[model samples]
Target: MNWRLVFVLFAVFAVGTNALIMAGIVPAIATGLNTSEAIAGLGLTVFALTYAVVGPTLPIILSRFGRRTIMAGGLILFIGGTVLSGLAPDVSIFMLSRVIVGVAAAAIPPQAAAIAIAISPPGREGRALGLLSAGILLSIALGVPLGSLLGIWLGYSGAFLFLASLGIVGLIGLFFIPPTPKPAKATIAEQFAPFRRPAVLVLGLCAFLFAWCQYSITTFFAPLVKDSAGISDVEVPILLVIYGLTGVVAALFGGRLIDRFSGYAVAIGGFIAITITTPLFSVASSFLIAAIVVVVWSLAQNVTFPAAQVEMGRLHPANPATAFALFAALVQAGGAIGAAVSAGVLEALGPRWIAPVAAVATLIGTIVISLLARRLRRQNEAQSILVEATVDEAS
Candidate 1:
């Protein structure tokens, strides 16, 4: 195993945690900032929104720099943002800090994906990507609960300071990482070419729609679970643990699924499963039932990511990092919209309707993408047969 790559992944995992787990401590943040919970939630909403917009642009702006240069610069921005956010005296400044983090947040997945794919081989792409995805799941598993605990113990500001400190640790770990050899270079327009491929376009659309549905409900999973199951506030962290742990297992298993069946299938099928379960989540009467459903949903969600990534690796086999980066960028784009909509859903229908509504959207997107996948598969098979026939004729 490549230790440098491992370090890169560890850094990525830690950074992803920083972006994602802040919401878990939002209540604590509200208290610290002397603001309403609603206001604190906006911090997340704003970061995601800015991250989405910047995700695409950042790669382009930083193209002149080496991947190592970009990654290091990005980490510095993340640590700076975290520190500023930690010290902010008011809610507005706190949000501004989050935006700084968002700028750095866009820089992470590309380097992480590049590192993961760089260290692996062709046939094992799915497995490698799966393990990388595992880092993401692991962070969720560990980061949120730990953050919540820190918030409760030392206050939200202290918790954020710790998070910033984690960013610095990741940066140091990343410094020990060896720089990846540059792949074939592309102009901005060339980098954007994948945007026009039918398969890529379809997947991008599917991602956005899927995000809209999934994020709407997931943003409020803790509260939803608590309310649905009548669980005490203490149980939220434990249940979140359940949710995160199951996702880790899913990452391990989902990689095999991708390696065997192809990433396209895993991507489409996972979303379908999520769509099917959305109703259950929306209406589960018992905490245990909701927990079970959330676990399944989280598992399925974990699979779709690596599956899509493995596909991206194969799809743009010539420029794997760029492919993965574009996929990561699209995820943020969809997430931005999804997160924004979730706030509206939370306010309008009391969270009961969000999952089902998202389910319907996922179902719709799945149908279109599944059809496209079939068409792509058939085209590939037909081309294979033609090559074989030509070889036979030559013999």
Candidate 2:
């Protein structure tokens, strides 16, 4: 195992925790800031929007400095943002801090994805990528629950402080990473050119739709559980721990499934899981039922990401950074929209409506993903045939 790669994965874990910890503790943050859940949810929306817009741009502007600098810089910015959020006196300032953290959070994933793809030995890219995805799930499992607990004990500001401390550890880990060669700089046109491919665009669209659906549930999960099961805020952390632990298992194993099966098959399986589980989340009446549903929902969600990342990475092997950046951008765009729209849903229709709406969206995403898989299959066959023809002609 490459320790450097492991460090990169840990950095991703820390970044993901910083970005997603809010989802688990939004209500606490809301009450602390003397705001409504809707407004607090906007913190999620703003963070995701900043990530969607700024993530891809960071690689371009910071390319001259190289990935190492970008990674270190992102952590420093994240620490600063977390400090600001901890000290924020108003909802507006808190939201602004989230935007800063989101922008900083954006820088890590593409760099991590690029590094993961670059360092993985042949035939293990899926497994390597799976490890990276697992970092995110681990955050959900470990970071979110802990953060939620911290919020209950010390308030949301304390949770922010805890997250900032984690960032410090991740920054220190960076020193052990050996110096890496700078990647060839890609032009803006080259970065965006992959969208011209029908398959790539279709995959990106599927990612967008699924992400919207996934985040719809994630952003309001604790609140929804409280409404459904009459749980106190203190209990949210424990349930989320259940949610995260199950997801961690799924993430660790999901990569092997992706490696053994086709990305298309793995993705379709995940889509089916989400389509089925998301609606169930809406109607689950008891805590036990919801916990079961959350486990399955998290499994599907955890597995789906590595499959999608692997596919996108394969799609543009020459420029993994740009390719994964576009993928992340679309996913974050979907998440931003999901957060914004779910707030309206929570206010008007109630939290019970969120999963059903997400199920509807996931159904559409599944259809598009099927088409993308078929397209890739056909493209692969054509390329194989061309290779065979050239070999025969030479013979």
Candidate 3:
């Protein structure tokens, strides 16, 4: 409802939108740079891999800067990257541009999320964080295809131009937003200290699994559609649209599930539900089945963070920003690893392997998550009993 959330959403939208635009422009980038499609795709892989590597580190480096200043700086980096990419005459320069974008985009999210939650009124955090998360989820759903379409219609230069323009709008929106005090600096090791909690560790691990599952299916979803259903090239984008629309619905409601039920419950429940849907996905051979499975996958995917954030807050009530930075970095790392692993599998096996691999992964993640849940419950009980004993003795 406030303008701050709007600005935060705008920043996230622009950053996420640009990151995904690479998938759309792969072929165009190849043609433009006179490289192979496989080599062109490295622009995305390198960006994601660097983001995974640098996401946690950026917050510390920007610790002395105001939140708005840091965000604006990131947008500037993105603009510069976009410009360089548009002008890049070689594959190496394009790859460099993508990495530059990755480094800047890394700084935006954790700081923005921290700002949103710090100012949020009690009990309304779920709502506020959901709004930010919704922006992120919506970008994946809506922007991917749209960016692809832009690339298709206007070519590489035009596609990069649209993305560069988005960075400008985001920067302007960020300029008007209020600045929060910079967070205290923490070394990477210290930032990760919160994971010393068993529950936090479990949450991080589950998030990793979620990323693996999502990237496996998503990176290859259209390819599966093409290979399995004999769908035409043009229809791929349309089917992807349906997949993204499902995410918007999920993002709108997933926060409530975390608010109403425990985040731990949502995590396990989401994985289980996905497990049921994976078989249907594996066998999908028509638009209808692809549509249904993709929606189910998106729904389950959207809930992972809201649910994890709830537990994260309960575990580290003091410093969610630092926690968020670590969580985000790990999530990106998981995605990078997932994409690499899935790509390897796809090469050796085939596209249909995506669903089965994801299905087995979900099951494994669920098992690990169940054990984690029990451990956290026990830890909570132990802490409660110690507190009660202290109170009784004091009386």
Candidate 4:
């Protein structure tokens, strides 16, 4: 294992922890800020919206800078924003802090994945990408739960502070990694060239849809679990850990599967699994049953990330950072929409509707992506046959 990559993974973990910690601590935030849980949950929506808006553009604007500068700058801003979130006296300020953090976060993960792909050994891209994706899962598994405990003990503000401290560690670690040279400047048209490909377009849609499905349920997970399983705030983290741990395993294993099989196949399998398992949340009447459903859903959901990332890298080999930034933006956009939509559903229809709605979204995404993948495969096969026929005729 390259120790440098480990630091990159750690950096991703810090960003992801901040991004997701709110899911575990939303009720505390609601109470502390004198707002409804639905309103407080908009903190995440704010972050995702900001990220979706900024993620694609900022990285391209900063394309001339080296990865080290971009990563370090992002961390500095992230730390500042997180600190603000911890210190904010009102919900407005807290939401503003999330915007700042989201902007900063926009620059990190896609760059981190690009760095990983750049530095990884040949034929191991899937594993490298998987390792980084696992950082997000690890944050869910460990960081969110631990943050929840801190929220229970100290306050929601304290949880934000703890996340800030992690960002500082990632900042220091960045200094030790080898410096990456800046790429030559390119025109805006060149930067957006990947969008011209049909495959990239379909994949972006898949990214958006899957993220929509996943976050719709997860952004409000604390309340959903409580409503469905009679679980308390303290117990929410335990189920999150189970979900996260299962995701971690799936991410690592999915990476190898992508390496051996096809990213398209692995991604489609993941989507199918999610579609099948997510609706089961409606029927989970006991903790054991809920946990079982969580484990299966986590396994299915986590695998899609690495597989999509690997496909993105392969599709835009010359400018992978651009592809990754686009994918990240779409994912955030979907998450923002999902969170906002689900909040309305929770307020009106109740938590029972969240799972079924999520499942429907995933099912739609699965069908669209599956059709596109099949077409792409057939095109490739046809091209191969044409080339072979020409060669045989010449011989």
Best by TM-score: 3
Cα lDDT tens digits for candidate 4, 268-375: 999999999988887788788899999999988888888987887788776677789899999978887888899999999999888888888889889988998899
lDDT for each residue of candidate 3 in 1-395, tens digit (9 for 90 to 100): 56667877877877888778777778888888999999998887788777878886676556667767777888889889988888898988899998998887787777677777666666666666677778877777767777778888888788888778877877887656666666556665665567687767777777787777777777787677777766787777777777666776776688777777777798788888877776566577777777777777778867766677666655655556556666777788777777778898789988877777777777887888888888878988999999999999999
Clashing pairs in 2: none
Query: What's the ranking of the predictions by lDDT, best on top?
Result: 4, 2, 3, 1
Q: Which consecutive 10 residues in model 3 have the weakest lDDT in total?
A: 313-322
Steric clash pairs (candidate 1): none
lDDT by residue (tens digit), candidate 1, 1-395? 45565666666776778766676688878888999999988887788777777776566556666667777888888888888887899988998998998878778777667666666665666777777778777887788777777878877778778877767776787667666666567787876677678787677677677767766676777666665666777776776778778888888778778878878888888988888887787677776887888788888788987887777666665455556666666776776677677778778887676677678778887797789889988998999999999999999
User: TM-scores across all candidates?
Assistant: 0.87, 0.86, 0.89, 0.88
Better of 1 and 2 by TM-score: 1
lDDT of each: 0.75, 0.81, 0.76, 0.85
Instruction: Kindly report which residue pairs in candidate 3 clash with one another.
Output: none
lDDT of 4 at 89: 81
Segments in model 2 whose C-alpha atoms lie over 4 Å from true places: 22-43, 88-96, 152-158, 222-237, 343-352
Candidate 2 residue lDDT tens string, 167-212 = 8877887787656557566787776667788878888888898889
